[model samples]
Each structure stands twice: as C-alpha cells, then as structure tokens.
Target: MKTFEATARSKSKVDTYISNFMKLHPFAAFLTVFVGGPLFTLLAVAAAVYLIALPLGFIMGWF
Candidate 1:
C-alpha cells in the first residue's frame, strides 16, 4: 500500500512536469515532430543505403 502510494505520487510529479513542459514549449514539440522526424528518416535511409552499397561494392570489386 505504501509502495502504491509512492508510485502514484511519483507518476503525478512526472505528469505535472511533462504538462508544464508541453505548455511552455509547444512549438519545440511541433518542430521536433515536423523537422526532426524527416531528418531522422533521411539519416536512416542514408545509413541503409550505405550499408547495402558497401557489400555490393565489395562484391563488384569496386572496393
């Protein structure tokens, strides 16, 4: 019962903190999803392409 109370208190604190952060930095969140999402996707695609190309280059004697 004490542990459950402590856990609830901890969760409430975290929820309050996140709510404050979102209220203060709504645009930061928007930009993170809007710009950061595509940038991360582009980086992931580039990494995959590089990985695929490396073995192909080696197999084709281009390395």
Candidate 2:
C-alpha cells in the first residue's frame, strides 16, 4: 500500500490550506495579502530589479 503525499499547488489543497490559515490567524493572513503581497510585488518588480530578491521571487513562483 502507498500513501498519498500532499502537494502545494493543488486547488483543493490550497483552498483548505488557506482556510485553515485564516481560521488560525485571520489578522496575519489579512496583513499578508494586503501588506506583504504588495510590498513583495513592488520590491520584486521595481525596487529590486538589480538584486537577487526579484529573480528569487520569480523562480519560487515558477517552481
């Protein structure tokens, strides 16, 4: 018999994971989406174009 390993990008898995996160830390989740999301995006897109952080974000998103 084999057990199923969990994955990160599966739709159902992501949904449940997000719901669990929100349930556990509503404020943190909210701040992540509203604050961290934009800050990271801006840092990666504009501010850090010459830095490793921008490319690292793209690589992580691809994988």
Query: Where is model 1 more than 4 Å wrong at Cα?
Result: 1-21
Q: In model 2, which regions exceed 4 Å deviation? A: 1-9, 47-63
Candidates' C-alpha lDDT: 0.93, 0.80
lDDT of 1 by residue, 1-63 (tens): 999999999999999997888789999978877999999999999999999999999999998
RMSD of each: 5.1, 10.2
Best by lDDT: 1
Number of the top TM-score candidate: 1
- Tell me the tens digit of each residue's lDDT in model 2 across 1-63: 123344434667889989999999999999999999999998877765657666787888952
lDDT of 1 at 60: 98
Poorest lDDT segment (10 consecutive residues) of candidate 1: 28-37
Candidate 2's TM-score reads: 0.54
lDDT of 1: 0.93
Q: What is the lDDT of candidate 2?
A: 0.80
